[model samples]
Target: MAERQDLTCDVAVIGAGTAGISAERAARKAGARTLLIDPWFRGTLCANTGCMPSKLLIAAAHAAHAVRHAPVFGVNPGSLAIDGQAVMARVREERDRFVAFTKETFDDLPEGTAVTGRARFEGPGQLVLEDGRRIASRAIVIATGSEAMIPPPFRDLGPRVLTTETLFEIPDLPERLAVIGGGPIGLEMAQAMGRLGVRVTLFDNSTTLAKARCAAVHDALKEAVSRDLTLRLGCETSAEAVDGGIRIDWTGDDPGRAVFSHVLVATGRPPNLKGLDLDRSGLALDDHGTPVFDRQTMQCGDSAVFIAGDADADVPLLHEASTEGAIAGRNAAAFPDVAPSERNTAFTLTFTDPPVASVGASPEDGTICGRSDYGNQGRARTEARAEGVMSVYADADGRLTGADLCCPGAEHLSHLLAWAIESGATAPQILSMPFYHPTLEEGMKAALREICGKTSQPVPESRDFGNLPGG
Candidate 1:
């Protein structure tokens, strides 16, 4: 029998997904000899099946939808025939290109810096490969990412059921799709499929869509999406196999029995920590079986091991994952010495027709600084998308703190609010900024001005401020 080989590195990063890649790069840049290990080279779930592919599908769907509605703009386009197969093919092709790009980036790393194998922890600061090779490292980073959580009841459905992990690989779009969650992924796919001419029914046990913290935003989203698909919210549901497809029975405000060619489960995603043998590493797990680690440093239980990205099970967005990965990598490379870093203010977005976005803290009973109902906004009326709301929250002192937007340009608006809140910009300060006429941003300006009027603080006079030559 062949003897087991041994390797050594200053830092070992498990999983080559987005977080893993960021961690590895950070470690190497911090002067640590880094080794990255993964079972495949297709990059993270986002590249393979999640963000990229879904966006491609959504873009195509949006194109079809636009052409169908172009008559409103006095530009009458001819008949639109959506070739589902062609759309799927384009999505797959673009998805492969992204995957190849990520793989190439990994391949260009210093030779011998990466290994392709399944790795598991043998003990503290030690890893065992499938081929009997052992690796020793001063510190380790776990960025294994996550997978679609298939509930126990749906395990036996075979190919008839789909999740984000496997949804993009299908050859053709199902004629009837039953989306089993109302979260970001579920809503995105449900609306996209419906736009592409698929019969879609969306089910959610929760009473609200996207779990919007604001009641107005929730109502606007539910009303807007109902125009596309049959939304069954606040439902108790069960499923069973039928000859041609699966039958779903539900009890809700607008529920009944129906059959779908395919069922998509987008309930949630848990950490992917199946075989890493974390118990041997001296790290503790929470009641939910997720590793307990310091959110700021990504360090776990005074050990050299750190956790980040989807494995952390706190923030799952791509941007948050990359940020967490950098923190984990830098701290792991520095070991006994920790680097001081503060997480960015909270920001998240969901891409629907009228996108949903939240920034900084959730709006509570704080003073309402600004508000805009898109239904009356001129820009929205021009774009024929005038059907949502924008709200800004501030403390009693009139400093911007948070916002919730369900409007035509919520994505961009959210970023603006997040930056203002992070920088301690006051309501009057935001209102003092220039807002061009006949634009969607005018709505934001209106909201800001409203809040400024309500604030007890005196508004700064524009004439007293320095004026540029253009002004």
Candidate 2:
């Protein structure tokens, strides 16, 4: 072995992904010397594989869907042809640009701030790089990120099996696809492929689509996406290598067997802790094998170590990961005397046709709320995409608690609710806000009106307010 070299920093952040980047910036902003280490320096999973590329493909798929359904608008475009190869190429081109931007951002970090090598724990506050370099730090943040999890049984299926990591790299779209795990990633990819003319069969062990907390949203999502693809929910599934492809077998109320050219597994993500050797760090692991970290401070137990992003398992969305990273980084830099950061309201979205969005606190038993079906909403009907529902929930005190939306413009609606809930807005206040006529936002207003009626708070009467200054 070569002689070991030693370096010291105020903070050391593992992984150069989004979380790692945010952590580094936060630590540096706190006047601490920060070092970021990773073997590969692609920006993040979102820019490279998860969010950006998937949306590009979804955009192309939506274009194809729109042309095919143009008759509703009294416009007939004839013989719409979809070139899968061209679409994939365009997605790659745009994805590469995003990846390049991430790389550039990393490169622009302050000089001597980053190292390119795999790092493992040598001891508490110590890291050993692959080539015999050692780093001593006052604090450590594990933002090592995660990898797409393929169940053990399907690991040996070779190239026919794909994950978010590999799915975007395919040169051409497959004739048929078997998507396992009907979560956001699975559903998004399944619908995109189906809309792009690929035969897609989606399998989920869970009975509900997207595991929606609201039954109305769950039913609406099932109704909307099931129109484009075959969904086999609430099933136990198995797969085997076939002659030219793969065979998927499932047992349930909708049990069946099918062969597909490719199988995309969006089951879950496991933290990339294989080589970090957390056992040497003296931090306790949770039931999921992740380091025990406070959600508020992002600190691992009471140690000088921190965990963030997908590594925590509890916070998986990109924005949440970034938030955790910022918190962990700041706390790591100020350990033993740090002010804890308050977590934002829970917000998540699935990018489908009508989209699926959930925000703020989850609905619980005895929770009274309001519901609106977009099928009856004017905007959705006018757009010929009237197939979803929206629900807004408020506590007995009339404060907005949460919302679930499986409707057109659900993304925007979720943001609105997240802001309101975080700001402690009441249902009556939300109802009093202006809702323009014949817009998707009117659907939100309709739900708010129902919630307003359920609350003990009196709806504002026009006469209750004073006249304008001019009057």
Candidate 3:
């Protein structure tokens, strides 16, 4: 019999997902002897399943849509057929390449760092592996990513009912697909399938889609629905099955029956905190079942231990997960005392046809300055990509509280918004930043200008400002 090994490190990060990997890198950069652990693979959902593969599939669907519809642009490209199985293969190929790329990155990390099998805490600052080995660390980071929130009645997924994770593996595109939940995941999948010539109907339990983003984001998404996707608004799903293909029952206040061939549920996500005994580690859970910790420090219950990413609960997006992971890692290495990083910012992107991106608060979160929409512009039409809008909300002082965008380059544009919010830059300051013309991001600049009541000069940064709008 092999002898059990006991390991020790300055920091131990659990789950090798986006947040986990980021935390590992941040910890090593901070000179902490870090031990990163997960289930063999170094990359989590973003690397293996969630972000990468899904986006690739969407990209393929977009290409197919573009090719078939090129005649509208007078290009005369005709007769397009989608080999969905081949698309899935290509997606898988890309996924494998990305996973390998990440493995290479992980291999380049400094020594004394280790990644092991599934680990469970025996006590505070102590973990036991599946092989009965033990590892000790001064600090811990829980970056375990989230899993699909399977809707009721369809909890047992099969031929007809599918979750986000399983939907990616689908070989055949359904003739009609019904996606429950109007959030980013649901909208993206709905758009992808709809573009691939599937009659896609999306249901938003509430009034809006992508509720976390701005109303303008939904406005843009509505344009996509106008194009192809069918939306069943103000509806809630009761159950689903796959008899002939798929059938879902949804009920609204009005008299109507909604059914489809396939059901994809993307309502929301619950943290992957089940099975793991958090109470044994002295962690407190919030109402959302996420780890309740100091937002600044990522400390759970005590400073000696910490957590990050979806495992922590409320903050679920990739950007939030990475930022929280970095903080947790830094705090773990610099135990007892550490300078707080004011660089806490998040950028969220919904991977749709014209992907929606957002930073800061939503209009629903008690806005100071209300929202405004940048309607369909010539740039989007020219690129054949104009299907969304952009909006932002800020306070009287022009501190950005929220931004929502549904447009091309929304993901990239949202980062700028996040930067402005983090730096306390007002809407005027954002407008002051020079943006190249004929770009989708100009919409964000335009939005800022509309709120600030000024158009920036060609060389705006050179001006000697008397008082900036927010200041």
What TM-score, over all chains together, does every model reach? 0.95, 0.96, 0.86
Best by lDDT, which number?
Answer: 2
Once fitted onto the true fold, the runs of candidate 1 whose alpha carbons sit more than 4 angstroms away are 1-4, 365-369, 459-471
Global CA lDDT computed for model 2: 0.86
lDDT of 1: 0.86
lDDT of each: 0.86, 0.86, 0.72
In model 2, residue pairs whose N, Cα or C atoms come closer than 3 Å (at least 3 residues apart or on different chains), thus clashing, are none
State the lDDT of candidate 3 residue by residue for 1-471, as single tens digits.
Answer: 778778888888888887888888888788888888887765667767678888887898879878987887889776888887787788888888988887786677667475668888677666787877788887788888788887666676566777867776777777788888887788888888888888888877687776545555676677765576877778766664545765566777653555677788887777777655666765666766566778788877665877888877656777778788889888888887755666465567777766677677767777654333344554565776655667877776666777877777777777877878888877766666665555665656545545554322232445323233211
From the highest lDDT down, the ranking of the candidates is 2, 1, 3
Clashing pairs in 1: 369-451
Candidate 2 positional error at 429, Å: 1.2
Candidate 2 local Cα displacement, residue 138, angstroms: 0.4
95-118 per-residue lDDT for model 1 (tens digits):
999988888888688999888998
